[model samples]
Target: MKILHVDTSITGPASVSRKLSAEIVEAALRRHPDAELTVRDLAAQQIDHLSSAHLAAAQGTAPENAQVREDIAAGRSALEEFLAADLIILGAPMYNFGIPSQLKAWIDRLAVPGATFRYTESGPEGLVGNKKLIIASSRGGFYGPGSPAEALDHQESYLRAIFGFFGITDVTVVRAEGVAISEQARATAIDSARGEIAAIAS
Candidate 1:
């Protein structure tokens, strides 16, 4: 199996999502001991936001500067990595009730016309449906099904929508929410998420 491990947390070792994602990756490795793993830390290697130059370059225009060329190449590389992976382990931490900008930028590279998705007569059709996606989601507050803050949850929701748009239906979420509520709450949430991971591993 080809596994793609993507980490977007800016908190380094203090990131809960990072810890869970690493554990998920380890479990996946144990399942497929010979799996090839590729790790991409978006916080460390930031992909530049899409600009007019990037759009123009995508339309067959030559890159105007070295920076544009480098950025465009990076975006292509990111898309290639996504396309090559059989399973994806994503570390996503909520920031202001949404995902990090770096992760969004990486996603933009994947949402290409006729590559990841296409417009059919019926509507939009996703091309990359063969891959499995597991999200390690960490949130500071309550945002589950019936929580008061559920409507404010754009992190996991957006991730699901985008990946679904890419035709991926085999998606799983291991979430640790309310981590900032209290020490006990944080511990309970993490312990619960670990339990879910244990099930996945088994």
Candidate 2:
């Protein structure tokens, strides 16, 4: 088995999403002791945002300068990493009711046309398959269904839509929300998320 772990939270040790995601990976590792691991700490890594030049390069419309070429290669590498992994764990925290821009940047790399998905006569079809996605979602407010802020939530919802588009429908989210509501709320949320993580079958 191969596992790809990506942590986008910039809060280091104080990040609840990272904390939960680490535990999730640990549990999975225990179940698959021989699994290979790849870690991509977005906050600590240098992943450039996709730009017009990169797109042009990808489409073969523009000559590849050194930086443009490197950017395109990095995007391909990121996608290849995802494709090579059998299981993926992502630490995603809600920022202003949405995912961090860093995570969005990484998604752009994975959403390659004719690579991750393709347009067919039946409409668009996802090309990537047979992968498991686990998202550790952290939020400062409640965004679950029926919550007042649910409509404003784009974090987990967007993720589900994107990964599902890539044919990865076996997605699970371990969420710890309302961390800023109060100390007790934060503690309770974290504890609950940990329990969920512990119960995971890897």
Candidate 3:
């Protein structure tokens, strides 16, 4: 088995999402001892945001500039990494009720039509399959199912929807929210998320 771990936190060692994501990957390794792992630190590597050149290339237009060709190649590499993984672990932090720009850039690269999805008579069909996705999400405030802030949770919701578009519905989201509220809450949330990881790993 192969696992792709993508971390998009800019908070460095202070990032709860990064810590939880690492723990999640550790758990997966415990479950599948021989799993090969590939880690992509998006904040560090900084995937390029889609430009007009990429848009044109996606539409099958020939690259007129060297820079455009470079962008297209980079996008293709990112997409290939996603497609080759057996399991994907996303370390995502909520930024203003949505995903960080780094995560969004990675998503833009992978959401290539005819590569990740297809339009079928029934509807949009996902091209990627047989893989599991685990999202380790951190947020500043509590946004559980019944909470008032639940409606503000576009981070996980959007990820689920987009991955589903690619035919990956077997997704598990482990959230550690309210970390910025207090140290006590941060500890508690991390512990709770770790317990969930343990259960999943077993």
Q: In terms of TM-score, which candidate is strongest? A: 1
Local distance difference test values of all predictions, in order: 0.96, 0.90, 0.91
lDDT of 2 by residue, 35-118 (tens): 999999988875789777876777778644787777677778889999999999999999988999899999999988888999
Clashing pairs in 3: none
- How many clashes would you count in candidate 2? 0
Kindly list the per-residue Cα lDDT of model 3 for residues 1-202, writing each as its tens digit.
9999999999999999999999999988988999999999999988788888777777889989987787677777888889999999999999999999999999988887888999989988999978899999999998879999899989999999999989998999999989999999999999999988888887
Compared to the true structure, candidate 2 yields what TM-score? 0.95
For candidate 3, what's the RMSD? 1.4
TM-score of each: 0.98, 0.95, 0.95
Off by over 4 Å in 1: none
144: Cα error in model 2, Å = 0.8
Residue 122 displacement in candidate 3 (angstroms): 1.8
Q: How accurate is candidate 1 locally (lDDT)?
A: 0.96
Instruction: State which candidate, 1 or 3, has the greater TM-score.
Output: 1
Q: Model 1: what TM-score? A: 0.98
